[model samples]
Target chain A: MISVSKLLCGLAAAGDGLRYDDPSGPDQITEQRQRKPVVVWNTTKGCNLYCEHCYAGAETEPATGELSTAEGKRLINELAAFGVPVVLFSGGEPLVRDDVTELVGHAADRGIRPVLSTNGTLLTRERARDLRDAGLAYAGVSVDGLPETNDAFRGEEGAFDAAVDGIEACLDAGLKTGLRYTVTERTVDDMPGVIDLLHDVGVDRFCFYHLDYGGRGAAVQDADLTPAARRRVVRRLCDLTREYHADGAEIETLLVGNYADAAFLVEYAREELGATAARRVYEYLRRNGGDPAGERVADIDYRGDVHLTQFWQGYALSNVRDRPFGRIWTDTANPLLSRLRTREDHLSGKCADCCYRDVCRGGSPLRALAVHGDPFAPDPQCYLTDAERQRDVPPADGNGVSEPAD
Target chain B: MADMRERTRVERSSGDGREWETFVRQDPDSSLRHVGSVTAGSEGVAYEQAATLFGDAADIWLCPAEDMCRYAERPLCDRIEDAADA
Candidate 1:
């Protein structure tokens, strides 16, 4: 995830230190994050709504052999033991499970900060209060677009209203809540409306997710914005974020699922905001260590499979049911997992030669897999041009002038 | 709690008699639309029911009813039953 607010606007988002190793961020969180990754546990595969781009291909009933309450608690124990700093309780919809609060409390008790990712239609006032009381740190509610568009995308007529209700419930119950929007050709136009509507409703954070090709999402791969369109959307998001900050709105905006935003931000800064800003953005992206799939982020599916990422459920390192998650993650003996950890060494084609490879690590390997049938292939979604991907000669001094060759 | 490494495998049952909400696409060009739902013991049964019910459709999708939690005003099960009645 790229914090547009932090990079362009110089805002210190709550987890900036831990996420980007920003010196201005909290030292304690950064120290803990260095030791362990953030885990997204797909608590169940059951969901009320069938979103067009659902990565999990979520259904209404929990998948056969979903981790039981006891099993979930054990997983929490394993994560706590592994020193995982955060556990995002995600699912078809986490609220579907009766034991969600208990699980959250268990994670909190074990020193793991438990957060949530849900559709938000079910987050009633009582449910939000229960979750807060159980120690949920944050709740990210997915709201793809405006009522009509979001309803069309989510396969529910009143989903938008219900989700808004859910968000208000979370805010009323004193839980930190945010909006999660997946950018697609169909939904991109509704972004301004979503932001304005949710912002008016008191939501301070908005996470815009790039559509990744996985699960049902693969069916709509064509719906992903064109390269030029994507760049325009991102630039608009940056401008909107700046506007919010300028207005003292204190709104936090983040872009997720695409690390190209890292390099794009630097370039955007250089061309628009100037050299010093570009340098600062570059330094932060460097600290972030590029696409964090196999390193900073880990996914445990409903059943016990550990994926390099939530979107890359196509591959699994091992099952936590058979081995401890810590042991599985650290094994690295799995060739795919090993390669993903050091993708800089394995990246092929345009990605291998791209100047910003260090900052993007070839973008999302899952997208590459979807397009090229090879995880090491160049990310088809990398919108950077040939000139932009070239490494430039370093400037001799602090000024933007390049030094002559020796 | 048992140590992760030392824990014994527990017997688990398959999702049987579960309600699966069905979706259908009229043709290749159309998006999947929510149809009615069917009660089945497994994915195979669910698929069979969906294909039989929405036979003319080009594609079919099913999600479990238990997974969808919604507000009391419009429960997913209630909607499914209404669709079934329709």
Candidate 2:
């Protein structure tokens, strides 16, 4: 239940859009973005495959990014200097960095756990073992569907098999392995099969994403994700999670689709866990879940990582003197997130007057800006976008009891 | 024994080809057999205690010695392998 204080805060938020967009609004942007953050360090811009659906298509290679061992050390030193507890290192392929093992060791020395996201094509048993030895905590592999389906999307013949092998290798090595499945128009048809594959591969958990219409797939928007498809996908994923829980596997169900379910889950989880813990889970999802650009830190592809916006640029943050990757909570000054965050969100046309405002946050700043050209604007697909009372959702059962729903 | 806090019964024929019906409760790691005998490992439950109730499936094969041990020793919940098969 919302406290009168928070309710008042909600009222305050209603005025924030007005204040923030005002020419006379105080210079609060920097203050808003100055909070402590989890940062990504791009180690390499080199990759091996050329996936058609990849947002980082042309940028996943060494030429796009480069940082010598010394340069890599400098970035780590800077994060440590700022007392940053976690640093995500990504690249064209972090595993390609010759000093990745060393970088992992350095991160371990600094008491930072390195987690990563990769296609898993280069994640051989030996490499996984080596990375584990080097103190890489976990690695997420990208596998869309079963072999026939997955291999096609990955644009590699043996990618599915390699990913399977990578998961087994990581499990055997006693390292955590997660599967990343990007949803696209082609992949939505096989949601059940995709869920089954997540089990068959025996991954510890899986992260789901509907096809992001950016970079490589941007031009293919018609063939990309449909809002209806995303809802269907999240519903199935929610059920799959229920089954996994019944079977006794630890499952964290995530919806990287239209923000509808994600928004609801956040409110529900918050009511169930209360405030502080809920905030942590939300931040954890943003940082540990896939970054918009999928920029990995030193762990996944140790070579060099790129920003979510720089994926197709094919370059490295290490190549430059200062790291260029965006911070999750500290992007107010960031041109991309700033431009996206300022405008009226697509859902704002509806969310501004609704109780679900805090939960949905006017839908994703990234996605709404992608479609409607304004992050602060109301989401076009939002049921509330049309001002229908039928579209508003109850906050939750204020008793803080969550009846499990599959 | 299944270590589950709750469970739904699912009956299937075992490779041993025994037409025995069993209800087991299990957790993520283990299960407790509450019916027809499958594996006969000594799970430390007493036997003769249920001898009177063994009248129907008492073909020794239907009610293995260990099954009695489990039923006899374990109350409602216990941690033992295949205790549910009991």
Candidate 3:
């Protein structure tokens, strides 16, 4: 996840230090998070609503062989032992599982911060309270667009209302909650309205996810925004984030699933904010160590299979049931996992030649694989033009000024 | 007695019987009640069974049958009676 607000606007969010590696970052929590990868655990595969872009291909019926409560607790113990900072309890919809709070509590008890990613339709007042009491740090409720658009995307007519109620429930229960919006061509127009509606409802954080081709997401690949459209949307989000901050709202806006945003932010800053601001953004992006996947992020599916990232579920390194998660993660016997660790060395085509390769890290390998059938192929989703990408840019100096290239 | 013991051993190892017992509560105010049992090769399978059968339940708990220790001298008892009495 790229913190557009932090990189471009210099906003200091609670977790900004984790991504930007800010030297004077406020707390020990940020330092702790910097050392560990955030783990996304798909607790269950059962969901009430079948979303159009469901990455897990979630269904109403539970998939066979979901990790039991005992297994889940054990997994949490292993993650904590491995020094994982955060565990995002996600799923087709996490609330569909009866042990949602129990798992969240287990993660917390083991000293790992627990967060939730859910459709929110099932997040009733009681449920929200239970999750908060169980030590849930935050809950990101998916809201694709405004009522009709979101309802259509979710494949349920009343889902929009239910989800809003769910968000309200989380807010009333005193649980820190935010909106998770997947940016797609079909729903881009509603972004502003959704933000306005939810912001009024007390949600201050908005995560805009680029559509990654995976699971049901692959089916709607065509619905992904065009390069131009994506640029416009990202610019709008950056503008909105700055506007919100200027108004003293401190709204946190993040872009997820695309490293292109890193380069885009730098360019945007240079063109709009000035060269010094651009250099600062570039330095922050470099510190972020781009395209986290096999480095700073991991996913453990319902059956305990660990993947490089949540969206790269097509491949699995090892199962927690078969071996400890940390052991599996460190094994690196799997060539793909090993290669992903230093992916810049193996990046191909435009990604290899691009001046921003150090910052963008070839964008999303999963998207490249889905589109080009090559993990190392240049990211088809990189919106930066040939001239922009090929520019002989200088590295940022210690003083946030660009040093001449050798 | 020997036959019963042998049968129990076979059942535990065969992986065909309902080795996992599941419980569920309808809501926070409700008491957890034993819903059913499922045959599973691993903890993940057992969870899927419980979740699928009681997806709408407010809470669900699963336990391996072998992990359960009865207080009485029941057929499934695996612990010493004195341990419970103490």
Best by DockQ: 1
TM-score of 2: 0.60
Write one digit per residue (lDDT tens) for candidate 2, span A72-147: 6655554555454455555546666777778777776766556666777777778888888888876777777778
User: Can you give the DockQ of every candidate in the order shown?
Assistant: 0.05, 0.00, 0.02
For residues A45-104, could you state the per-residue lDDT of candidate 3 as single tens digits? 889998989888788888777877766776777688789988989997888899889888
Interface RMSD, in order shown? 18.6, 32.7, 14.7
Model 1 alpha-carbon miss at residue A81, Å: 0.6
Candidate 1's residue-wise lDDT over A1-406, tens digit each?
7778878776234444324543222111463475578898999999999998998879988887688777777778778878898888998898899999999998998888888999999999999999999988889999999999999999999999999999999999988899899999999999999999999999998999999987788899989999899999999998899898889987878889888888888777777666655666777777777777788888988876677788866445655665678988887644455677888988889888888887889998888877876677888888998887884622112444322222
| Backbone steric clashes in candidate 1, count | 5
Chain B structural similarity (TM-score) per candidate: 0.60, 0.18, 0.59
Instruction: Give the Cα lDDT of each candidate.
Output: 0.77, 0.47, 0.76
Docking class of 3: incorrect
- lDDT score for residue A92 of model 2: 49
Relative to the unseen true structure, what is the C-alpha lDDT of residue A189 in candidate 3, on a scale of 0 to 100? Answer: 99
Q: What is the lDDT for A154 in model 2?
A: 66
Worst 10 residues of 3 chain A by lDDT: A22-31
